[model samples]
Target chain A: CTSPCAAPFERRRPGFLTLGCRGVSTGARGDPHSEGKARRAGRIAVCGKACLAKEVFGETLNESRDPDRPPERYTSRYYLRFAFLEQAWDRLAEAGFHMVACHSGCAAALLGEPSDDRTWNSYIEYVFFRS
Target chain B: CTSPCAAPFERRRPGFLTLGCRGVSTGARGDPHSEGKARRAGRIAVCGKACLAKEVFGETLNESRDPDRPPERYTSRYYLRFAFLEQAWDRLAEAGFHMVACHSGCAAALLGEPSDDRTWNSYIEYVFFRS
Candidate 1:
């Protein structure tokens, strides 16, 4: 069990790194396990995006019951990790898009200032994260 | 004769790339050539920095008279180009430095902006170029 499992979160656990779980229900409070079980009982079949669905059930017993194995590359663990990394890289790249001109004129200043300043300091920051 | 020599000036000539000559004598006016001669006859040897001095007359007939080549790297053409490139790179890098935290927090934001904005528009611009 991950250390997070012991520290019962009060305010509905805010999202953090989740790829480690392959979207499998950890049976933790606020986890999707109970909802999934209830939905199944009601026969209200719920389908999710393929990637998300894989994320949700890829680690459970049902995953092993299937005779065919998902490609190792498409395994929930690998896919989730890749998704996480790709999201981070995309965000970083988006933040970078804010200053196309500045990087061209002044080299030293751009390279020397702190990193967060460029993304969070100006209208550009708002543009990158919010808009 | 330089291409610029053919272009007649109405208002005072704006500065351009000028480190092609040594600080000896180019015989070109508004170029410190006549200034150097007039000052010499008038007993006012307007002194300049060694580096700047090397820049002015480094290409004229006088340069041939001197045996020293002033390290091949320090020649006007070389130094001026180097200085220009260094200054350009410094400015670009400085523009880059403005987003230090951004670069760290979001790798893409800082790298994508143009070269002038980081140094020209933001308060950081005043901080870098003006201050």
Candidate 2:
């Protein structure tokens, strides 16, 4: 998975390269299997704008299962790994790549949420140039 | 200011264009002149890692001025205008551009803060392609 994933980036140099991935919560705590079971059992229901997650991933929130919990609280997908932007920048720097640009949190705006500083930091993109 | 600022973007087409700006706090409230005066008078002091703001902008926190307040609470620069990412996307789309990438919040990591979801959303960059 690592080599194939990195091949394209290594092959291109002295050229603009853009890379990005979905941001996952570093403090996410929950059991995906249990969440899936609960969702399948209809114990989970989509809440508020979090329905965007369901629309994109076919996943439902556990809000109905626990009414007292905040609506924003939800289980993250277990398979997705969180990416550390700082580490990525370090590695890229080591590879002689300089950052041309970086952006994050626009996904919230794309999903029709209010365009504000409070936008979910759920996606990140970086543009790098190597020479 | 508007025409000169937009000239470069309009001049380039069918090519990669990356644009970015420092992100400002949307809900920031306070007077910059007063904050500067307080800092110069030593009524304010740098608190924790927020000293990065000082290193970059010569600004200091009001922690000493109001020890009872949270250290994270501070006045923002009054001259900086907040940009709405959604509005930018809309305008870009209307101008016959399509987003190639977007990223935000990496400034926290660059300043040696813990790279996590809680990174400050203080910068945004977007790469667009027109064709």
Where in model 1 is the C-alpha error above 4 Å? A1-80, A83-87, A92-128, B1-92, B95-97, B100-131
Q: Going through the candidates in order, what fraction of the true interface contacts does each contain? A: 0.02, 0.11
What digit string (tens of lDDT, one per residue) describes model 1 on residues B42-103?
01111112222233324421333233644211221122223232343244233222222211
Q: What is the TM-score of chain B alone in each candidate?
A: 0.15, 0.34
Docking class of 1: incorrect
Q: Lowest-scoring 10 consecutive residues by lDDT in candidate 1 chain A?
A: A37-46
Give the Cα error of residue B98 in candidate 1, in Å: 3.1
Model 2: per-residue Cα lDDT over B13-129, one tens digit each:
233333444432221125433322110010111112122222222322223333353322232221112245455456556656567655543322111112211222234445554
The lDDT leader among the candidates is: 2
- Compared with the true structure, what per-residue lDDT tens digits does model 1 show for residues A1-131? 33322332322222211221111111112221121100000111112122322333244223333335432222322222222212222332332222122111111123334432332121111111111
Residue-level lDDT of model 2, residues A54-119, one tens digit each, is: 222232223334445332334332111212233333344454556666555433222232221222
Q: What TM-score fits each model?
A: 0.12, 0.25
Distance from true location, Cα of A33 in model 1, Å: 48
Per-model i-RMS = 23.4, 15.3
What DockQ would candidate 1 receive versus the native complex?
0.02
